[model samples]
Target: MKPNKHSIDFGKEEQYLNSDKFVDQIICGDCYQVLKEMPDNFIDLVITSPPYFQQREYGGGGLGNEDNIDDYINNLATIFQQCVRVIKKTGTIVFNLGDKYLDGNLLLVPYRFAVEVQKRNPVKLINELTWIKINPTPKQNPKKLIPSTEPFFIFSKTDNYYFNKDAFLEYHDKCLNNGRKKVGNEIGKKYFELIDRSILSDEEKALARKELNETIVDVHQGKIESFRMKIRGLHALPYGGQAGGRLSQIKNKGFTIIKIYGNSMRKDIIESNVETIKGNIHPAVYPEFIVQELLKLLTKEDDIVLDPFLGSGTTAAVAQRLRRKYLGIEIHPEFVEHAKNRIRQNINNHTLDIFI
Candidate 1:
């Protein structure tokens, strides 16, 4: 469909709107107006953190001018209506949002937006993950309590949407092993018992148990004849931590023990750290980790990804890095320049692997 020319004013900003320098370029214009021009089912994934209603100044305008909560929901739904039309049937939309506080009442903007998106679009509510900010700024409310964290709503257009369970699993693994330590005497007793209870002949048992006994001896051989060293080494080796050092001292030793008696487990998602363009063009710039994770999960190398509210071009940058095609729309000129510079820099730095 042709774009609604009435809503867009691509006068002097047309220079940055289209570019051949970056394989995935940034467009400078209103997102609602620009999205209408894109072809249908052209994008693979849509991940963005839209401006919160009436929260902060994004230079384009203020987000908190919705008049009321209902108006905010309606406006968000209108944007998603267009987003749903352009997104592929198998595409996934992950929206990072937070609640808004007004008149001392905390409005659940995240939940409200999720409900509105599901109501207006064909997306399915998949997960409501909490992004617990480790070092969140304390809320400055004298009368009430402090709020610290936010929510990320993960939605999909179909049941067969892309999800990298392995990446999430790796995150879970790190969290699980944060304060893990082995139970020294208890573990030793269990290990010895298992060795003694073997039904094999003496020679067979000796050979089979030799490896286990050697492993235990190696732990206590050079170190102080304590179980701490053994347990520390075991934990470190599995977690890819430092192998041998005085830093391996088991202070306040904790153990993340995993008992595996049945079948082997496999994770579905894979995760990696991705770098971002150096500049604060958008306030709520999503981490490249998120974009890379989404790309790995949702689409193939050649698939297309779309971001209607392409703040600082994180989605496009990640798409380029992962060798995927991307289309981004931004409503602000400053952000458009920021995104364009970011894309160009990534291309020059060999961060983006453009396919065509």
Candidate 2:
């Protein structure tokens, strides 16, 4: 059975880390202590943005408040190892780390931790996805550029990690319609002209026209947003450098068409407005949309999603909305209440459909 909607500050060690009794609970304690109680292979996804070194005042002197750079990276690496231990072999971890400036030089803190995590843990570095902040905090220093991006490192113990690619593309298909090319009424006109001009037999031209008509029908049905038909002698080779069956298809068929649903070319970068709040208990509250995207990409309904850093409980709220079980661990007491309230409000105010 699913746990209650509200967050729970874990206490009484006897009842802790029990997935059935507290599947969606937020354990309000040091993650180091909380992670120790979690069972191996318990979580399917661990997506969280931990405290960056000296960036914010995350109470309880957690990983970020260390005295030096090495200490900070070491502390985060320790958390990374623990998270890997709790996650299943098929699980995936997405840890977003922000960079900092020290002594007028940009400290590569995020990369440092990533290197250390790979060195100490038995995991593979899958992707270093960059997050471009649309509205970053204004910096008054004229000599340095404004800091606006962060890195989300995807790690997994094995290649069997669960990734929902169709669900991911479906979201960007809806979210990136404005950025995609238009499927105009004269979409297939140019292809027809190119086919007529190409050096092909009448039989080849007939085949190309048939395929072009089918492709345009797909655009009208919203199966795809656009297409590119490469007719022999009329256009360059689609696969000049790549080795695939596509090269032979152009040699034998005289034409080939590429279908793009929408935003299929956009990869490895996330863009969202910085969620800057005034007098907030948790200083840095990440954008909820980013969490939603990651959850959709990495998990399915009823899968366990863990956030060791928890912060203001963005993961828990998104997990609940997506019908995934969540386990959150936070250090501060006041932020625990803030996270619980946020999750409660999200559940009460909005209803979300499961991943299609």
Q: What is the C-alpha lDDT of each candidate?
A: 0.61, 0.80
Q: Model 2, 1-356: lDDT tens per residue?
A: 11222112233243335454447888877786678777788899999999887887665545676667786786677778889998889899999999888999888998998988999999999988888899999989999889999999999989999887766546657666655566678889988988888898999999999999999998877677788877777676765566265667688998888887555554888888887656457778887778888888889899999998998888898898988998898877788888898778767978684332
Candidate 1's residue-wise lDDT over 70-143, tens digit each? 76676667667777777777777777777887887888888888887777777788876565454455667688
* Residue 283 C-alpha lDDT in model 2: 74
lDDT of 1: 0.61
How much is the lDDT of residue 279 in candidate 1?
Answer: 52
lDDT of 2: 0.80
- Lowest summed lDDT across 10 adjacent residues in model 2 is found at 1-10
**Which stretches in model 1 have alpha-carbon errors above 4 Å?**
1-23, 62-64, 168-278, 352-356
> Which ten residues in a row are the worst by lDDT in model 1?
255-264
Model 2 off-target regions past 4 Å?
A: 1-22, 175-185, 236-240, 243-251, 264-266, 277-279, 350-356
